[model samples]
Target chain A: MDFNFTPEEEAFRDEVRAFLDENLPENGTRDMEAVAEFQRRIREKRWVGFSWPKEIGGGGGSIMEQVILKEEMARRKAPALGACFMGLAWVAPALIEYGTEEQKQRFIPDILDGKYQWCTGYSEPGSGSDLASLQCRAVREGDEYIVNGQKIWTSIAMWSKWMILLVRTQTDVEAKHDGISCLLVEMESPGLTVRPIKNMAGGDMFAEVFFDDVRVPVENRLGEENQGWKVTVSALAHERSSISEVYGLTRSLERIKVLAKSCHRNGRPASEDPGFRSRFARADARIEAMRLNGMRFLTKQLRGEPLGSETSINKLHRAQLEIELGELALEIEGGLGVLVQGDSAVPDDGLWQRHALSWPEVVIGGGTPNIQKNIIAERVLGLPKD
Target chain B: MNFGFTEEQELLRAEVRKFLDQNCPLEEVRKLCETPEGFSRSLWERMAELGWVGLTISEEGGGVGLGWVDLVVVLEEVGRSLFPSPLLSTVLAAKAVDLNGTEAQKSRWLPGLADGSRIGAVAITGDEGRLDAAGIALEGRPDGDDFTLDGEKLLVMDAQNADILVVAFRTGSGEEDLSLAVVERSAKGLNIEPHRTMDLTRRMGRLHFDGVRVSADALLGSAGSAWAAIEHLQDCAAAAVCAEMVGAAEGALKLTTDFANQRVQFGQLIGRFQGVKHPLAEMFIDIESFKSLCYYAAWLLDECSPEAPLAVSRAKAYASESFARIGVDSVQLHGAVGYTWEYDIQLYLKRAKWARPAFGDAEHHYQRVAKLRGF
Candidate 1:
């Protein structure tokens, strides 16, 4: 197999490198204006949605080109291509796939321009991994739907101007997955309330959004009235590059390596300690494995094959890798690992501790390891259902 | 960049898989357990006829000019069958010779090896079988144009069946002052002693030498300067070992999965239990990771990338351990029958466990990686 990029691809990579060299924020810090400028320039270059169709204001790049763009951007530690994270990753893609012509004209451009933040309303306190069991209700009214629901773990709800919501429109369907529908609701609509919730790392990045008779026009529904599951399914398919996550892991591992160099055990650099070395090397190897697997996943997608349950393999690997890398950081820190951010003399301002406490986002929020394992076994390995 | 197999490489893989399916079935592996030589000579020749014996031998040397990536493709299938043979030794040793052998030396050895007329074994470790500087046990003393080699090489793979032994010996006390020599097994002062290893499909032996005199022509590369080449050869071997493991673990996991699907328990399939199925799922995950890592390492080696050394260690360190984990889980998932002698699962387990410390296990590679990444 050839690992070398074709000359044209390499030249495109060079062009991306040149752009990044000029535009990437110094040391990964981008002020508000700089972020806006970064977004504007990438939009001009059509690099924001490099693989999306040009008709949708995207770059219309090939799959490998997209991989190249991401690999380079991640290697340089550049800011994300757009300011609206969920919007770019899922909301826009979902809208493009299922939106009406008017809806596309109204929403896609704003999302591409990063006009405002977007939040998701899916899981309630009682619904998590079994998200289709959500109890949120959206009753049909003339020209509009009256929504009433409580969505816990609704990330960015407090700041987001809109929410892509999943609500139960027909509760009597034979299957749990059949009755749900997706809705786009303006956050400013009356009867909506958001109470911020602090995560274990003490960050108020998400909230509990309460919907009390918030009316959304019938036209705002995504896909068919009882087929929101398909929208959600298709939207969820737009994945963040796990290879980029591998790069992030590589950076974190490098930090731990540096920490180990300075931290000493038994009068030797912790890097020289057999235990520390073994664990660190294992982290390195696991990341490499994940990187290679990411490439395989990319290959499958490029070949027009559905990813199916294989993505769970890397998801599970990431969960364990995240936990291991976080623990390794703290292990290298020794007693100082106990200190939280802002503490005087805390290592990297307690970044490792914060990461260690924030495993829920990487592990539990999307799909717990148990859930991923079940999917892999039943779907991928063709094992009997558990 | 495309990180995938070419059409040719993919076809080679399918061919190897089909060949192993026909020539080296589980029953064949079990039958060879009783064979004194461990591997069938006819089977080796048949494989040679397929050009896999010379799979990676240089085209300039009258063999296929494929790189380590192609060799890895064949090695993975070899691992899947648990086929008893000296392909690994011959491939690895032939590579060392190709890398360092003179024109005349290549002429003398490469043709015979490529045509399956000769077999080769490489001995790089001492009795400890630890693949590191501390484990270099054989000492070389100069006798004019010849060197008298003394000291035993331990865990020499298929040494008893080899026609030539390419040995690593210390020419001086310094770790870097080591040399490699290709010696005929018929040398008067040399002996091969077989060992009953845990993995019956693959035999192990120890090479004994008492002032075994070898002419200057037998020495590979410059005298006392082959240490770097040896390390490079080890890295290549490390990559091969990882590839082999990817096959072995994948095979073992498949067997256990099939068993889990059919084996009834408490009036239900055992696989319905999360205890049985989840571990198997986890095993699948581990196997895929090993496969990916091994393939990438092979790619790096084939490309001659500067990252080859680190990638090789990473693959070896992870694949070896992951294979063992799958082996244990396979047996545990299979229950009592898995532990029986009549069962074939133990062979995979033995090879998996044996592979861990065979080529600088996880711990050794960790040190290598730490050093490479700048300890």
Candidate 2:
């Protein structure tokens, strides 16, 4: 019923604002040294792994506080807390949940310190939403497991120093999920190769990574020998938190407002156009709805309630919203929308074009809208499974 | 930072819902919708007896003195049952009095309106339904110590049953041009032509105010000030309407899902099909989103937050479209029989249609949001 943050939370918000005033990047730009320094400051503030357990080099922040930190950071458009997007977002949490003490000690600090990057290897050419049915083979030989697999859509594979990979160690189990195993593999391993794949945005942010009989030590095996499915499920859920999307959408909305004020059509600002304002307003409302829904989930999490399948609601919304925002931005640009970056006449330097093309990362990547819908339908609503 | 109903509010919701189930069920609603009057006097009196009419006004003003958020809980239940009454109009009119009426004016009208002894309605907008200050087209000319109103108020809800009409009209060529006047329904020059609409459960009428004259004391607040009252009522009403629409959407989805669970097609339950379930699932998402937006908007208004207007517009716009989609899909998912007159799906669909544009349609609110964002 109460929407006001507690005075302490308000004070914490003030603290975050002050920190941002001093340290947030100018125009959200980041250099290597700036990135390292930013990561160091946040890690010292214990915001890098804010919601993870303190025993594993985390801040062990209360869920609500973590939400506040995230909201404020996103509002300021601050760079991500650590350099390892996948590792800090999913891998570290997975390791804390399933990895041995040795694994935690060996990996948690570097991940939090921005010392190296980590990529994911769950989706194969044939494995996406049905990731548990992966056919990437890993045969146990003495103290090492010989792996052979090709993982596609592995974003950052070319730049990552390590990977949290999923493989089939025993294909004879009764269920597909039971036969899979998780492994921590080094990218510089003798038999591994990365071939960067240029996306529609004409960027090599994602790649096709091939593992040719790579030897991963037995100690690198995460969780049980054949229980990688559980780890992957948990990690993916973490990946779909929706908190980040709320912040991201808020920033996008602000940009859209600014563009509406500046962009002109028919000898007046597009913001003055009823049609243009209506679209931007609709987007604003949807984003606000998504943001409030995110807050509801945060409230639930604060109460120690497990956020079961409801997070899918935000994921589904985020999918549509990202596409809508990109289209709206381009629409605001009128004829210049078709022009790409480096074009003299283009607006926002083709940011909207790249954004429109980047829907795959959001809409189709973590779980397609269909997959999220199915989850909401069957799990959240308790309807008959389709 | 919690954005949910309190424990007492939860109990109040259950109680209201149970009362609606007993007194305002679908069968009763259907019976009323088919009738010319479109509402049962007995049920309306019973609701009033339950103090539902005074749920939001202050104690001295003969209300429960709760805020808009609490009122949303009641509205949602009313929407779920498709309750046939003049409750929303009465409540809004009563709120207008509380916000803009002088003390003497309040004392004269507040008790009657809150206790439901006398019903009230507000004609805030005229033709085209643009809900801003400039939309007040019911012209009022200064006549000595009185004002003579001329023109009609379109789509005035429950005008036939209303005992009082709080009319928003433009008075003269001055900064203080817009004003509100409280006129009795039995006034000599006023005419109420009962009308029909897509939503049969709710009565509508055109208020033809030909030379409707009232003393200057009839005016609520200062001259040229009804705009603030109009905006306040719009914000609160929009949030409540969202709640109502979300509830109706939830109800329709339930009807659709129940039918899907039993109805077999192609040798399988229709619920087993992705076609049937996916849209129902999407409706669920929209409903949840609408619920959040409604609550947030209500919260902002209750707190008198500066962002209240934008939040309310956002809720109204999203709820309008979401409820419409849910209403249409609810019928479509039910197959051939759902479109028939005997089926209840159209009840929700019709209400969705009317409620969407009542305060402001999706496009209207979107335009409002644009303006509010300083676009």
Q: Which CAPRI tier for candidate 2?
A: medium
Tens digits of per-residue lDDT for model 2, A77-194: 7888777788887898888889899999999999988789999998999988887778999999999999998899998998999999999989788877888889999999999999
Query: In model 2, which runs have C-alpha deviations exceeding 4 angstroms?
Result: A28-30, A235-244, A261-263, B173-175
Candidate 2 chain A minimal-lDDT segment of 10 residues: A233-242
Q: What pairs collide in candidate 1?
A: none
Name model 1 segments beyond 4 Å from true: A28-30, A235-241, A303-306
DockQ of each: 0.71, 0.72
Q: What lDDT score goes with residue B85 in model 1?
A: 89
Predicted candidate 1 versus true structure: per-residue lDDT over B1-375, tens digit per residue = 556777888899999899889988999888887888887888888889989999899977778979888888898888988888899999878998899999999988998888788998899765687776657878889999889998788898889989988999987888768889998988989989998788887788988898899899999998888878888888898889888888888889888989988999899999888888789889888888878888888888888889999988988888777787888889888899999987888888988977888777877887788778775
Which candidate wins on TM-score? Answer: 1
Which residue pairs does candidate 2 place in steric collision? none
Docking category for candidate 1?
A: medium
Instruction: Judging by lDDT against the true structure, name the best candidate.
Output: 1
TM-score of each candidate? 0.96, 0.95
